[model samples]
Target: MDRAELVELLTPDGLTLLDSVGETDAVTDVVKAVSRLRAEGHAPSLVAAVLTQVKLRRKAVAKFGDFASRMLFTEAGLEQATRLRVAALHAGRFTAAELSSVADLGCGIGGDAMAMAAMDLAVTAVDADEVTATVASYNLAPFPSAEVRHARAEDVDTREFDALYFDPARRTAGHSNTTRLTKPEDYSPSLDVVFDRAATQPVGVKLGPGFDRSLIPENCEAQWVSVNGQVVELGLWFGALARPGVSRSALVLDGEGTHELTAPQDSDDVDVRPLGEYLYEPDGAVIRARLIGDVARGLDAGMLSPGIAYLTGDRDVTSPFVTTFRVLERLPLDERTLKRELAKRKIGALEVKKRGADIDPAVFRKKMALRGSESATLFLTRVDGKHAALLCERVR
Candidate 1:
């Protein structure tokens, strides 16, 4: 069916034709219409429900079936929601008394704004897309004082807000490719512009979890947050929200095992020690924020290698920022020996982690002919400028 037909199908008269459809072709037409509607900022939940109904009856077009399958409630959707909620929760971490007015810059789908308003913070949510703005308005309907505006973050004035929250648009028009906004000027409102305007007020920015550490500004306090053992988002707090000597933090939220680690400032010169019997590796966000040292000191652990971001302690220590691993054995990075040991142990499934190793994990795993074994994590690293492997088990 053509775009016209699909659009027609979405109309009241055409929707009534659903009772007459009995073929895969009709379902395919419906899928196309649903996809178009979704692209045009239609309610995803409604579209997804309709699509599921079509799929359940096995009426969907063969080609479109695969695409429709992606719409199913799955880990991807949960992960997205979890990540957004994590970021929203971090907004609550700002040590402000009460937010009278807030600006949610680049509020995609208005999730963050909705969360803020739910916390009683009056919000002005801004997004660049009209469809997103509409969706945002609907999402934030419960918060009567929350306003959804279709505008670029840069165009929105900062003076109207007592507190500012930013979640920069990470995807472009194609939506297939994603890139981080590193340079302060790359963001819509521009980090520098936002910070300059918010220097005196509380400001928080939600950044990608994988954001480069070097890009973090010195004036801000960066926090790495993990929800359910998955590192989700990095947050930057500036101006009144900033902490003292603590420039970075790692926050892990678990019902009974919550943890928080604060990183020491760069101005503080710290000593590094050798890797002990146990090694702890902080998450990417914590390492990027240059808070590994703080985490190490917090846990009474020392750095194994300076600038390596790995913590070492002989005794068991608990910290939210670092994943503790007990080093079982260390061996030279001899592919043949490694393969032989792995094969001997019937190790098939493996989780490969690399710090500064040159070998590709995929290639190495394939070369090992790994199969028919339980789960194992292989740590590939460089020790004394030589490739080495450490067999490790989770300390928890």
Candidate 2:
């Protein structure tokens, strides 16, 4: 939102109108609401601003749950905000370490600060973007112990806080339609400066899950977190916040609750073996943390192919770290042969999964022209260093 829209939305009438408009996402409803509000004599800008926030609040439900209704957001800020479930874990780290205060650098919409403050920890959240800082201030207003500042992260005096949390801006400066910044150097507040702070104090830095692993500092604990099988963030913890003897870890938060796989360093890949009755696709966080070997060991599985992420075994055992599939049969990698085989089985519904293969599932599915009620998962991957196809049924 621009300054004018922000100004309009901050007024009593603007807030009341936003609440009255309620949460809506359908384009038709948005149009009807816009027309009605405009017909009621509200300014066009205020109407637009309120509707935009209405949409954001609807989308924010996945991250903030019911708290999303009480929060304000920019498109970019909401996109980057940590899920409250994950943010609570981040807060737990500081609390576990007995840290009483935190400095949340680049605090987009105060997601982390709110989590910290909810735990009764004093928080100073800062954002360089004026509008985001203002929005964060509003989101954090309920917590008297949490303060929001419109200032550069480098300008903050970290000595006053017992711990520091850096969420450097990973996208180009904007409230919407911003491009992701790939290079660490391009990140706001300078990753180099953030690292320098880590050297002297307890710090946690949240970065993209795919951040270059080689650049991770040797002294910190690197953790990849996934929520409901989606790898979300890679958190680097330093000093007291860093767990001893744990250089790499994968945290999985799914319906079964939280599970973690950790090691002093990346685990070695299990040796490739013949394809077995069951196939396991390691969780993205586990694969990203290079701890698939640990999971394979637990399941008594082996790599399907060298350097491939797929694992296979004869055991019925499985863990939250991997999705297990019961292999049905092997099929030829060719499209014509597989199409004929699928038709024979009367399999219409399909889930196509691939690893170490070059094939678009959508195009392949269209070619099959499937017509039946049966369903199955087709894995296009390698086994023992050769292209192969494995027809399987999900093992829940």
* Candidate 2: tens digits of C-alpha lDDT, residues 81-138: 9999999999999999999999999999999999999999999999999999999999
Q: Give the TM-score comparing model 2 with the true structure, all chains together.
A: 0.98
Q: What is the TM-score of each candidate against the true structure?
A: 0.74, 0.98
Global lDDT scores for all candidate models: 0.64, 0.94
The candidate scoring highest on lDDT is 2
Candidate 1 residue-wise lDDT at 145: 71
Identify the runs in model 1 with alpha carbons over 4 angstroms from their true place: 1-84, 93-95, 174-184, 210-215, 255-257, 267-275, 298-300, 372-375
Clashing pairs in 1: none
